[model samples]
Target: AREVGMPLKMARAVQVGGPAWHWANFAKVARNFEWEKKVGNSVVVREAVGVVGCITPWNFPLSQITLKIAPAMAAGCTVVLKPSEIAPVNAMILAEIIHDAGVPAGVFNLVNGTGPVVGEVLGTHPQVDMVSFTGSTGAGKRVSELASQSVKRVTLELGGKSASVILDDANFEAAVKGTVSACMLNSGQTCSAHTRMLVPASRYEEVRALAQAAVARFSIGPSLDEASKLGPLVSAAQRDRVLNFIRIGIAEGADVIAGGPDTPATGKGYFVQPTVLGIKASDTLAQEEIFGPVLVVIPYRDEEDAVTIANNTIYGLGGAVWSASDEHAVKVARRIRTGQIDINGGPFNGSAPFGGYKQSGNGRENGIYGFEEFLEFKAMQFKPSAG
Candidate 1:
């Protein structure tokens, strides 16, 4: 908990993949196979792609590695795992568990080093058939470029500047609270955090007040504390980066309704106060990914304006739509151009394909879609019997 500032209960519940769920996902790969009955005497089959290079990020270290390694191994592809050095202890422990599980030695391997050395080699290696990477957009682009040299398949789960659109007819209190939670979860280090919130222009002050109050309710303290709803960021650099964004948000003329650029009184870890800012829809604070406990509220003129503001970013990762009617929320969600949008605080489903559009990178993860990333297709032809 101290190392990464994640609350113990939350970390324990989510960070490590439980035995049954992990095995269940492995079993899912078996179901990925299909028998095709074509008009002619031909059959199509899916086969293991080949060796896979899995580069996972520091956030949710064990889960990210498991998401890649389990599916790849299940698909029959050998894996070379490279976990972020920032939070690699759990990854090392996971490797021990996999080893104890009796996976063949050559089937799985772990390499510990920086992105420039080990990561670059993995991406460019001709023998590596595919690379599944999760990290920053810049790093993902570099991986794509390097992997392109060998024409290897690449799947990237990159950064996101997601939005949470609050419709005029939605329950104001519930929507605001839900959006605040979505924004500040994991101290806003999440790639899919709803950092931007869109509300009707006429109700801007009302929404802002609710959002500010919700942010205030968040208890910021040491991660080990059961009362703490928010914790310090990952590293000194990340803390500095988030603080810089707060400064920029202020310079951009956004009103800091709650929290500020000042450091938390603890003066201990990389703690940033839970921040909420009210800004113009087109402001820089509304566009950039701060990767902190900073939420930007942007008021829209109407439903059309809300959708327009939601899709105005270069990123199209995750978002949410809140409305009194489910049909109306779904309709607005369909137009938002994001990869995934939660409707009225819908719970996240692990089986669903999770990914993004545009600069958020390509390809999906989770369930069968994730497993297929390690597989290739083949077709067999047979002559029709002559009677």
Candidate 2:
């Protein structure tokens, strides 16, 4: 909690819950070897992708590291990790734990340094067979460029501006509350947070009221404070960036329905108000990732218009759709272009596949899908002697 100013509960998601979930997945599940089969005179086998290079971001210091390393280990692939310098301590502690657990010295190596020093080398190194990265879209693009020099296999999980679509049939109160809580999680620093809310134009005024009321329930303070539901952002730069986005949103015609770019009353920590914006689909606030406790609510004409507005972005990471019927909710969710979406405030399933699509990112994490990212197909052939 103290490491990144994350609330204790949110911090636990990385410090404890993440490792536990990945380990449980391994210990409880049965491996599927059905893909190893014969065709003609050859048999196909799944082999490790060899040395994997993992470049993780600071927002999820430990969880992202585990997400990459655990599956790499399960697939019999060695790893070289470059954890974000902004949040480096937990990774070092994890390395020590691995060493004490008697993992071979070279099997898992930790090199703590800046992105240029460690991340770039890992991307272009001849010996590194694959590179897995999580960060901004710009950084991910740089990683891909460097990895291309070595023909390195790459997986990226980057930024998001996901939408929460509230259909007319959905229980308005429940959906609005759920969306607000989800957006403010980790103070909206999460890569896949549902930062955008889409509502029917007919009910726009009604939703704005609901959204304001929902967000009013959040109490911002120090991570350790018992009264605090939302914590300060990671750093000064992060705080400024978020506030700037808020300002830009307003300049570009977004209305500040709840909180604006104003400084918080705390007068100390790097804090920005937990804000909500009323905006159009084309507004920069609705399209780009603000990456803080900011939500942009947009109004759409109809169901089809809602889906179109939801997908009208450079990102396709995560989103949510609410409706009276599960089938109807899913039908809308299917139309949105994203990696994952929730149906009527469905709980996050840690074991399910998670990642992004489009500029948001490429590849998957979590469950067997993530495990496959570290594997490669190889066919062993033998010529038959006169049978």
Q: How far is candidate 2 from the true structure (C-alpha RMSD, Å)?
A: 1.7
What tens digits encode model 2's per-residue C-alpha lDDT throughout 195-234?
9999988998889899899989988889877678888999
The C-alpha lDDT values of all candidates are 0.87, 0.89
Query: Runs in model 1 with CA error above 4 Å?
Result: 17-23, 29-39
lDDT of 1 by residue, 1-387 (tens): 655687776776766544337558767655655524464687777788899999998877777888888888888899999999898887788789889989888999999989999999999999999999999999999999999999999999998999899998999999999999999988998899999988888998898789888988888888888888888899999999999988988998988889989998975789999999899987888878899899999988898888888989889999999999999999999998888999999988777788999889898888887777787878889888998
Q: Native-vs-model 2 lDDT?
A: 0.89
